[model samples]
Target: MTEPRTETVTLNGRPFFLRHWGNERLPKLLLLHGFPEFGGAWADLAPLLAHRFHCIAPDQRGYGQSWAPEAVSDYATPKLVSDMAALIGDAPFAVLGHDWGAAVAYGLAISRPDLVSRLIIMNGVHPVPFQRALAAGGAQAEASQYIHYLRAEGSEQKLARDGFAKLLAMFSANMDTGWLSGATRDAYVAAWSGPGRLRGMVNWYRASPLVVPKAGGSIKMPDLPLEKLQVRCPHLLIWGADDRALLPEATAGLEEFAADLTRVEIPGTDHWLHHQKPQEVARAILDWFPDR
Candidate 1:
């Protein structure tokens, strides 16, 4: 396997970091990381896919060596989309996103379908289903209690001290010893420890651009309706059946959006499918790529 090469690129006029694996002759795969993480989230999976495709993972703004701005709006959807568009340029590549990156991927496919020929979302739901689930006010609320903690002041500092380690420990408790390696843990800590990283990450929850209704109000989807938007390209959704955060119900009606959707469920896996089942995840994506 070839070692991934890191490169510096400018997105939305701010410096960002990207790591690429495999030869330029292969199909391009753009990987997007989730909250509390950088592009390195795909480190374990990239090498596995490199044999067949060129994979590039970017450290989203405010996450690793990427530019960190003080204002919350800097993390807004428009700016984030613009940054992704700039990075995508003329390359019509496939995208895979997890968590916040998944949300961004959804927006990107909807806003600039020209750039994304395919999409793969792991452990993320459309904002519409998420909001409706939140309003349902029973199990959804219980599952989402962590969001409140994230939005609380001083949460970042607290996480920096204890929560960070706690999250890392959970991976060990839930997965095989071979799954959670020292290098992976170190990379996660390094990215999470970056200056203002946690704050910028939590800003997604605090400064939600989506119109969140009152407690009992009806839930409306985001600007793009997952149902109406015909994903005119190939789409794959890999979901962990045992995900504690986002329930299986969120994907209940996903077929409405995907004209050509292939769904795969890992019976025993959790939300961190890449970390828990790296090889499996990587292999699945490689098989899904066009002409792979």
Candidate 2:
């Protein structure tokens, strides 16, 4: 298939870089990428679903050529949600997010259910269960240790050193590096190498309030009503069971928050399942979407 078109549209007074596929007249699917990644993260998976859905993946707020606000507070949840809301406007579309993007997707569903028709998350977490697991602190707490490091000052420079060696290593967990061929690696380098982009991306971790407990400490769970956080839309989860970062416990009890939830697990795949098994990810997502 030919490469998707690229464009930048102003949203919330910021230029948002978007890579789009298929006919613009088709139904829309907003694909959100996580930290250390840009819109092109979906390069492999988006094409598989392009025929049925208009795949529109953005560089998000702090990645790639998109606007990079230096302040960590600027990347707060409310601001992130508003950026997406502005993008959707009155249009009805399904939302798909991976990693940090998944957080924003959940935030959108919770804050403005009317703006989202369906929610699809890959290796993403919900507030309640994730908080519970992080608070409980054991295996997951250990796996999430990197979160604290990323949140530290000057961490972005560490990730950017040696051509983003540490940042790229994040994706190498539990998956072959073959997916990140020379071309793919160069694209990511360019995205992360953007001035102020690394700071903006890392600010996501800094801006988040999720308390991942230290090795042995436990955090009390916050009281939040399901009514306020419920994902009323049909939601589908495509998980890579081998994910080392966000453990299975993170998504456990997710059903309580989503009214209609479909869980699909692909064994032998990790956090980069979309990259390792793009075809399978596409098939599962297409099957879950309305009208197939």
Candidate 3:
């Protein structure tokens, strides 16, 4: 098999970086990376699925070498969804996301179901269940306190004051071996400290106006209907049973959106399930693509 190649393309007029592996003629799978990371997060798993599919992992805006827009609204859900759609063009693809990427993928699936054929979320809650937990208070609020810190002013200064040591620490503390190497970690740190990236990354939390209120209430789109919002194409939920930020309660009602959902729980793994268990994550994705 050939080594994966890194490439760049413009999405909605913004330059984005991506890495692709596997056969061009095969079906395409788009991997969305989480906070403070890059397209390299899927480096290890992409090749495993390469023989049968074209795996494309992108460094969502604000991280890696991708374009990081200064405006907070640029990181909004609608814009992020547009960016993904623009990146993939008219191609039909399956969407796989982890952490923050999972949130973006959910919005993408909701706003433009036509672009995404299937959805796979790891270590994140479904929007409906997430909304429910937030209304219930306590755990949801506690789990989300970090957002306050992120959105607060002087965040950039604070992050920079420590010379981004905390950011680097979080990356190393959270992810597992396959997700990043020492060299990759250095690259991530550099990107975060780069000209406009840190501000762009935190702006995602700042611009997510739907989050706080939505967490405080249930899904508001009665027209679409949560139950009927199911992705008929197919869906998979791979979770790290030991996830810290998202607990089982948040996943309590995922069945509502996944008509044919396949739930796989990775024992002893944390919120960064993709990194903690890349082989298993890859296997779950492979199992979902029609034939084993």
TM-score leader: 2
Q: Which candidate is the best by lDDT?
A: 2
* Candidate 1 residue spans exceeding 4 A from truth: 166-178, 210-230
Q: Rank candidates by lDDT, best first.
A: 2, 1, 3
- Model 2: per-residue lDDT, tens digit, 1-292? 4598999999988999999988988899999998768999999999998899899998899999999999999999999989989999997689999999999999998998889999999998988889888888888888887888899899999988887888888767655667787888889888988889999999999999888887767778766676788999999999999888989999879888986999999777888888989999999998887684
The 10-residue segment with the lowest total lDDT in model 3: 214-223
Candidate 3 lDDT at 133 equals 64
Q: After superposition, how far is residue 238 of candidate 2 from its true place, in Å?
A: 0.5
TM-score of each: 0.88, 0.97, 0.88
Pull out the clashing pairs in model 2: none
What tens-digit string does per-residue lDDT give for candidate 3 at 1-292?
Answer: 2467888898888899888988778888889888766787776678788887888888899887888888887887778878898977786788888878888787777777888888888876667777666556666656665667778876866776666866655554543535455776666667677678888888877987534432443334322357544566577888887665677788787777767788888776787666667688788777777774
Error of 1 at 185 (Å): 1.4
Which residue pairs in candidate 1 have backbone atoms (N, alpha carbon, C) closer than 3 angstroms, thus clashing?
A: none
lDDT of 1 by residue, 206-275 (tens): 6665443443344544454545445667889998877777787766666767668999876668887887
- State the local distance difference test value for candidate 3: 0.75
Question: How far is 273's C-alpha from truth in model 2 (Å)?
Answer: 0.9
